[model samples]
Target: MAQEGKLDLLLKTVEENKKRRVEAKERARVDFVGLKVVVEGRLPQVEKKVSDLGKVLGVLSTKVEQLESTVSRQARAELLPEDIREEHLDASPSLSTPLIRGSV
Candidate 1:
């Protein structure tokens, strides 16, 4: 009778442990699903922010390109008159600039 009672108590303990494990596993699963839903809910705003940032970067890139081209054209316009005059003086056979035969 003592052995039978001990066996019943052991079986009851094992059944309780199994039920507790099942409940804990279900709780963990529910928590994981809730976290995933929360993260998914915020994803659209993140995507929108990324898209808006891309558009802003594109506009800035375009503005930089236009500014670069304008500055390049301005620099060339400023330097061209002197360059043309030098070319004319060097190409002429006149006595405007003396030529030294020893300096390459």
Candidate 2:
């Protein structure tokens, strides 16, 4: 009868919906697995690049520290009395002649 037909149509619709949901879930799983594989393949390269960057950063840090130390020493020397500055310059092998006072 009419009720039986309605029941059958409803059951058919429910089955179709269930099938669609299952297919969608399977597609999502496949996509996730593909993404996982790609990421796994590239992870090592990413890690290596990060490590290289860290090494570069370390070298840069050391250079900066050395430069800072040199600057600090120069600043301290500049703050000394003119006589002391001349003495230091005379003692340095690099400066064979003392700098004239008040001369650039």
Candidate 3:
């Protein structure tokens, strides 16, 4: 009878452990599925943000090119004599004008 009781106790402990393991697995599955859904939902927004950033970078690049061109022209003007600078500007009216938009 004592042997039978011990067997029963061991069986009960085994069943309890099995139940706990199953519960833990189910919780992990639920958490993983929820995280996947959240990440998928945010993917489009993240893509849009990346696209907008590309546009901003393009605009900044164009602005930087314009600034570099202006600085180069100024540096050239400073290097040349005043009479030559005036003659060059008079000969090329377009060089005195600002760059047109979307020309980048």
Error of model 2, residue 19, in angstroms: 0.5
- lDDT (CA) per prediction: 0.92, 0.92, 0.91
> TM-score for every candidate vs. truth?
0.55, 0.73, 0.62
By the TM-score metric, which is better: model 2 or model 3?
2
RMSD of 2: 11.8
What tens-digit string does per-residue lDDT give for candidate 1 at 1-104?
A: 99999999999999999999999999999999999999999999999999999999999999999999999989777877779789788888874344454444
Clashes of each: 0, 0, 0
Instruction: Let me know the TM-score candidate 2 reaches against the reference structure.
Output: 0.73
Q: Which stretches of candidate 3 lie over 4 Å from their true place?
A: 1-11, 81-104
The number of the candidate with the highest TM-score is 2
The local lDDT score (0 to 100) that residue 7 gets in candidate 1 is 100
Clashing pairs in model 3, backbone N/Cα/C closer than 3 A: none
* Model 3 residue 41 distance off true place after TM-score fit, in angstroms: 1.1
**How many clashes show up in model 2?**
0
RMSD to the hidden true structure, all candidates: 7.7, 11.8, 14.6
The true-versus-predicted C-alpha distance at residue 64 of model 1, in Å, is 0.8
